[model samples]
Target: MIKIGTIELDGRAVLAPMAGVTDRAYREICAGFGASYVVSEMVSSKALQFNDKKTGFLMDLGEAERPAGIQLFGDDPAVMAQAAKKAMAYRPDAIDINMGCPVPKVAGNGSGSALMKTPSLCGEIVAAVKEAVPVPVTVKIRKGWDKTSVNAVEIAKICEAAGADAIAVHGRTRDQMYEPPADWEIIRQVKEAVTIPVMGNGDVYTVQDAVRLLNETGCDLVMIGRGALGNPWIFQQINAYLTDSCRILPSPGLYERMSVMVKHIQRLCAYKDERHGMREARKHVGWYLKGMRGAAEFRRRAGTLETMDDLALLVRDIVAANSVAEEAGR
Candidate 1:
């Protein structure tokens, strides 16, 4: 177990907050599969301050999922503090400041990773949020604004000094975006430099990668982002691999996969209207079929689906066809 302030997480594997992903349905799924913690998608402090309906909807954590963190992004200290306070109403286990998003619109406004360039301002934001909330306050950061400024260690120290309970370091410079390799060495350095629990993220695609990150970086936790796109089983795989060095089990057969996908769609429908749910399910369906045989055709069908019934029928067909093909191969 790893302790972040007074809260104890069951394991070291966490789900990284992704903008349109990591909603309540996904968080509950990951928690069921053994993820230690899950962070909500980044919400704008400005939007929260304005009482945006969409932003308020994003903060909603269904009764099934608890102990999740709500992450906020903004450049203004007062606004950030107020946002953190507002997020507290949702009863998140913690509040996280997003200092690592490399998106142009976000960083261009001096929020997200732009905070890395102003260490003192970042420190002030952390202090303000920490003072405003009763729960643990954490900060997520990148290596630096770019390769030339690589100052995560320095910024991490400032956050710790400002009373952050923990720090999560994504080991890629803002310029790298989601590129080649994530510099685990820099993650290692940050872990070594900080007193609070450090969670290492980037390029962790498999259970072996998770093990390697822990062994190499000595970080208290590993946060999985792109790797968990269609693979919620990753949490179970990592957990099993850590406890027992067996080659982790493969994904379930086509029928089982379809069952999970169907459940995801139903959950989405329950959370939003049928039209919005079907629309959102398109991206998830694409991710679910990724790399599988006939996935291109399946993706095309899934994208054009107009109703829940259409989606369910399409998934059933995909499963049956795939199972028949597998039998023929055998």
Candidate 2:
């Protein structure tokens, strides 16, 4: 019974909110795979304050993805509070502040990881948002701005004092971006320092990785980012392992993979219209097709996907290409 405020999550794996990924359709898919919780893509506080329709749509939390949070990224405490208030229209189970984003456009603007430079400001933003929203308030943070300024413990303490319900720590510094190894030790330190639940995020691509992360960091949960791009089943597998006598599940078969990918893309098209959804789905298709037989040629075709019909044909071709290889291999 891991409860983030009033929201009770049955599983331990949470879907980390990615910018372009983790839309409504994808979140539903991840939830169906047993993700304990999911967070919407980061919505700019400033954008929400400006009454941005597109940004509002990004915060939509469907029933299929319950126990989900709407993540907001910004530097100003007052504006963040107002944005969180506005986000409540979407009825999110929680409100998460994005303090870990390292991209220049966000961090460069005194937002995201750049907020870490002023630890007090981070606390201020959390306090304001916590006050403005009725749901639980959580924050996602990194080790530090760089190796020289490691201060995750300090930030976690301040945020806790300012009323953060939980803390999610990404072990890499802003300078590290997504490269290099994540410093799990930093996550352990934060977990040790904070009384609230801590979610360890970074480099968890498999069930074993999730287990090792929880054991090594002593964190309450594991947040999957890139790991869940095309493989949401990791959540179900983790839940099974933890709750069912250490049982391990096999990877999805090729038929299941293609089937799920098609359903995911079809739902995406239905949600955002084919022209837009298919464009965004290109990367998703590439991820789903990864490591398959003739993946290179198939991915090249995936890149040019336009409509649901095109996706159907591509999936057929992919299945045909691999079905023969499987037959020959056996």
Candidate 3:
């Protein structure tokens, strides 16, 4: 079990907070699949403080996604603190500070990974948020701004000193930005430098990678980001392997994948209007159908879907195509 302040997680794998992904529908799905914890996509502190309409929509969490954290991004300490207070009405299990977003729009504003360049500001923000929220306050950071300035250890120390309950270290410098070969050494160093729970992230796409991260860095948890895309089962598979000494199971069958895709879209439809939901489901459907037979053609067709009936037709066509391929192979 991993403890983030008073929040105790039953597993060791967490869902990383991706900006466009990790919404309420996705978080509830991951939680049902046995993720140790789930964090919401980054909500802008300034936006929340200003009572932005869409920002409030992002903060809504379902009951199933309990023990979740709402990640907030901004450089101003007062704005961040006020945002934390505003977020309390939603009753998140924790509030996570997003210090690792590499997007230029956020970083250019001295928030996100830009704060890594100023460790003092990082501490001040964490201290302020921690003071404002009654729940645990954690920080997610990158290795540093660039190769020449690797300060995760220093930043980790400062955050810990400033009363952060836990830290998540994404092992790539902001310069790397989702490139191949994350430097796990930085995560190890951060874990060593801080007494609070540390979560190791970046390049954890497979079960072996997740296990290697935990064993190598001694981090309290491993946060799955891109790996979990269209593969919520990764949480269940990793948990079984880590907690029970079970063999890593093969990927789900095509029929099961289709079922999940249908259910995922259905949930999105319920959360929003059917028209908008199907549009939002385009990328997720693409992710789910990736690497399967005739996926390219199916993906091309799936993009044109505009309503529930269109999506239903697409699923039927996919299944019929899969059946034909199976028989031909046999």
Candidate 4:
């Protein structure tokens, strides 16, 4: 068991926080699928300092999603420290600092991956948050600001020295956002450099990928991002493979897939209310329909979803079409 301070992470696979995607509802859904740990969507330090009410929802961790972390992004040490203190009110098991996000809104503001450029400030922010919060402090950092820099080890060591409990290394530099072939070697380097636990992240899309990453880098955990987007079952598959003699679980059946998708969207609606949740469900529904027979057309209808009834209708249509496709194949 890996302990982020006092919190014991029971599994090696974790859900990486996505800005607009990893909400409270989604975190609970992923946790139900055996993700050892999950993180909140990125919260702004400045927003916390100014007492933004909307952020309250972002930091909400349900009992089902135990041992979750609330991720905060900002470069200012003092502000981040205050944000950590505030996030503690939501009772996160740990406070994770977001130093890995490559989005321009964050990086352009001298936050997120931009913090990787200033190793000293990164250290200061970790030390400050560690001081302000009662829980453990962790950082997520990229390989570097650009291809020319490549300084993850330097920053990892600094954060460790400054009281960071753990570090997650995304293999690409900020310059290569979401590019193929994430440099897992950098993750290996940071794991070797730091005594604290290192999580290897980037390009892990399947059970084999997760196992290979763990076997290859020897990191403490595998943090999965986009790969887990519409595929929470990846966690279950990874768990089975790791614990069950490398068994590969087949993908969910069509009925089970539709059932889970509807349940996920229903929870999203329950959490965010029907109007906002339905809008958010568009992309998620699209993701769920991936690889289905006649999926392109279904996804087009998913985009136009306006209410629970609309979603129910779309799901019924998907199930009917796929059922016939399966029957014919047999």
Root-mean-square deviation of every model:
1.2, 0.7, 1.0, 0.8
Better of 1 and 2 by TM-score: 2
Report the error of model 2 at residue 172, Å. 0.3
Clashes of each: 0, 0, 0, 0
lDDT tens digits by residue: candidate 4, 1-330? 888878888889999989999998888888999999999999999998877888888898899988799999998999999999989999999999999899999999999999998999999999999999899998999999998999999999999999999999999999999976899999999999989999999999999899999989999999999998889999999999988888999999888888888889999999899999999999999997888899999999999999999998998888888889889999
lDDT of 4 at 146: 94
Span of ten consecutive residues with least summed lDDT in model 2: 1-10
Error of 4 at 96 (Å): 0.4
Q: What's the CA error at residue 329 for candidate 2, in Å?
A: 1.6
Candidate number with the higher TM-score (2 or 3): 2
Clashes of 3: 0
lDDT on C-alpha atoms for all candidate structures: 0.90, 0.94, 0.91, 0.92
TM per prediction: 0.97, 0.99, 0.98, 0.99
* Tens-place lDDT digits, model 1, residues 12-116: 899999999888888887787888888999999999988999999899986566568999999999999999999988988999999999999999999999999
Best by lDDT: 2
Which regions of candidate 1 are displaced past 4 Å?
A: 245-247
Q: Per-residue CA lDDT of candidate 3, range 1-330, in tens? A: 678999999999999999888888888888888888999999999899788889998899888988899999999999999999999988899999999999999999999999999999999999999999999999999999999999999999999999999999999999999985888999999998889999999898888999999999999999999999999989988998987766788889988999888888888889877888888888888888988889999899888878888888888998899999999999
- Indicate the residue-level lDDT of 104 in model 4: 95
TM-score of 3: 0.98
